[model samples]
Target chain A: AAADDLAFHEFEEAANLLAETPDAATTSQSDKLTSQEHVAVVVGSGIGYGAEGEEEDDKTSLLQDEKPQPRFWTFDYYQSFFDVDTSQVLDRIKGSLLPHPGHNFVRHHLRNRPDLYGPFWICATLAFVLAVTGNLTLVLAQRRDPSIHYSPQFHKVTIAGITIYCYAWLVPLALWGFLRWRQGTRERMGLYTFLETVCVYGYSLFVFIPTVVLWLIPVQWLQWLFGALALALSAAGLVFTLWPVVREDTRLVAAALLSIVVLLHALLALGCKLYFFQPLPLDHVVPAPQAIPPSPNVLLPSSVQPMTTF
Target chain B: AEAEDSPGEQEATSSKPLFAGLSDVSISQDIPIEGEITIPSGTRAQECDSSTLNESIRRTIMRDLKAVGRKFMHVLYPRKSNTLLRDWDLWGPLILCVSLALMLQKSSVEGKRDGGSPEFAEVFVIIWFGAVTITLNSKLLGGNISFFQSLCVLGYCVLPLNIAMLICRLLLLAGQGPINFMIRLFVVLVMFAWSVIASTAFLADCQPPNRKALAVYPVFLFYFVVSWMILTFTP
Candidate 1:
């Protein structure tokens, strides 16, 4: 009964909106932006709560009845995005971890309510984990042999934090902008909010958590195996989630976008593994030999003292 | 949607009367004050029995200590009850976090030649930082709980990890061996899972139905990181 009531109210509201602005249905993306109120309602109901809104007609008829108010720059407006619960988050994490062959994660799990919490904390956790584990691996290596001069590289924490955070946050922002720009030219392309894009990238890092632990093993092949596994899982999740959005573009553009995403992800995992977990340099392995006598050209303390006495 | 909105309305209505009743009681009780003024000796006798300064102080202290201890017991055997939530306190969590950090500090100092104070601070910061971030995440996820309640649960769940850290420290005394390392690994892994289970059990009810996995993942990660630290303690 409630769903029926909501649907009736949505139908009535959308009809009124269409009657008020007869040309809204036919406007381009640029004109849609100028018509902020119309776009806000459409985006809120059509994309924000799109789980049951499959058809374009149904989408236009649906409304985000849950939004208390639609005004941006209000705390309440932003609060709605944070208003998710545990099971949904866990489901999203699982979606990212195990990519279904044909399924789109954004459509399946996160279409209705994409969130920023996962993206922020997942990146933060990954950064700290990498830094700490990387240092621990170094310490373990140093312990295996006593001659190596090892110091705690505190800078790795800062560097890791910056690199991972920038990749997670800025890359998504840039991707969202690029997609939006492309969306203007190509009306057939699927629309994605910035939050969904960031959410996908954030959850993709989950595979790296266990992989870093595996990297602690000193074996070269095992470390590489862990890195490759992490790279493939993360990239697969990203590609599967994003393919629907990019598929409508030219084949060249679509392939370019996917390759860039996968390449960036691969680089993050491979770079961290190689830079943070590499073996000690050869110089650190063997100490300078202590038995060598002083060269004849070099004056010893005793020789200098005899000359001073004369 | 109406069903969801109804509870919120009910809560608002339910809270309204309690405030009205409080004011009503205060007004009605005022009449007794004048009556009591005429019977000062009797009132003084009642006050003597209830409000002797030292006795009241000791009683309050005992009550607080018992509250903290009961919370610890609940943490050890987490169940779907409101006891932890209703009377949430940070005393137990503070103690556990401090002790866990201390254990980490002692082990690292013994293992490394230059185990400075930063190691201790690092563990301390990581724990409190993780707890605060998780609590904030839960809040952002629209959890129907208070901030401190979430923090208390996350903190108390570290008890198992603290025990694991203690066990690892003892095993290290026997010298490093493959068998000892395996045993330590097993202990840390078991305790890590225990921490996750206990925390999720406490937190499961507060999370929204579809988003339970989201809230639980962070709890898992937080415990896993601590467990990793315990497992890798070389000394």
Candidate 2:
């Protein structure tokens, strides 16, 4: 009776331990059996167990015929039950212990995955190529020709124009295309990108319109108007794109003031040209040529004159 | 002992007279205001023929005196004044344009944020371009060279041009951040360098006489390439 009672207690403890364990596979199967029991029991417990007789009978008969199982035994049940060593079981439990919780998270996330090298390579390659080609062309040109010197004025204007245009137009389009390709859908363009495009194209207009208008139109006033418009638009575009990134407000205000000054200079230049460049009347500027120093004989009396010419 | 010490002290206190020995050797070195003092009748001025010798000596003395006076003047008025007097012609425009460029960059960047002005950058761009064009045209006309030759020659001018621009910017834009200054300088240098190089390469192989004409085109080519690159790459 004591042996039977101990065996029953052991089985009950084993079942409770299994139910409490949080292993995914064990919990799922156990939940499945419990739901099955509830459905069977709702109809009628005795009828449900009797109707599920074949499966239940096989499990029960197997358990009854088996020898009394040892408590806290090894999973190797086929071996002699008497040979179960408690020390070996304890050693196995100790062997499966885990480290502190936060340690593994750092190891998994931070230390692995060395995959950024490729992207860096691509960026470096592109930057180097562009820089080399651009710089080489400029250097070689200057070297071969003593005259083609890159003046500060030229450098400032061209660099500003080119840098602005690139930042405004090219980078955005490339970004947009990259995103479209990557996501397989169009994304709303960034604000800066739009501003950059406007600024670049607007500035280009500033360059082109004046060139065209000044060349094509004889009227200085119309050309001035076109030039003014171009300048305004270009400045507006630049400000729109750059203002967000600037840390100081004073500089922004100063830039606006400087623009006014530049416009004034332009106006002054135009005024000078208009005032000084009037068409000259030819007759007054070029006196008619007299006969080559009237021959020396012509100045003297005809009697003393040489016979060579009249 | 005290009397001897007194003499020694007096001797130490007073400096030896510099011309002491020459006092009795004057021999009428000073001219008389009246009729010149006569030597012996046999040794008359005409007999000695000393007028030419006197005139030459006077000239030598005058020249030496003038040279010494100049030396003293130079020592007294050294030429180290900090006035903006020298080379204002070159410096003024350079300083003005650089300050303007820096201001434009700053303003454009700011205006980009606050959404106020758009014309600031455009005006600067035009001014710079105008300056370049005027310089190129003037150099060409004055040098009696063709446009291409001007460009070829101008291509070599990029380095000095950038150095001047940088110096100007440094003087004018002193309060700005180092990083900002460096970046601006870098971009300017690269663009100028590249354009000048390309212009030179293109114009170098072009045939003589006209080869000089090809110089300016490199600058123009640099402008073209940089503009295209910026248009194509920047954003």
Residue A126, candidate 2: alpha-carbon lDDT: 26
Per-prediction RMSD in angstroms? Answer: 13.6, 37.9
lDDT of 2 at B36: 26
lDDT of 2 by residue, A1-310 (tens): 9999986775554444334321111111123445433332322322222343243434333332333443455322312211212232222222212222232211221111111111122222222233333333333344445454321122223333443344434544653344335334324322233323332232222232223324233333454455455445444443333333221334554366345434443443233222221112211222212221232221113323221121
lDDT of 1 at A172: 92
Chain B TM-score, candidate 1? 0.75
**What proportion of the real contacts between chains A and B does each prediction keep?**
0.38, 0.00
Give the candidate number with the greatest TM-score: 1
C-alpha positional error of residue B117 in candidate 2 after TM-score superposition, expressed in Å: 43
Query: For candidate 1, lDDT tens digit of each residue in A121-224?
Result: 77878887887887777667667755654555545666788989899989999899999999999999987888888888888898898889888877655666
Q: What is the TM-score of chain A in candidate 2?
A: 0.21
Residue B81 C-alpha lDDT in model 1:
81
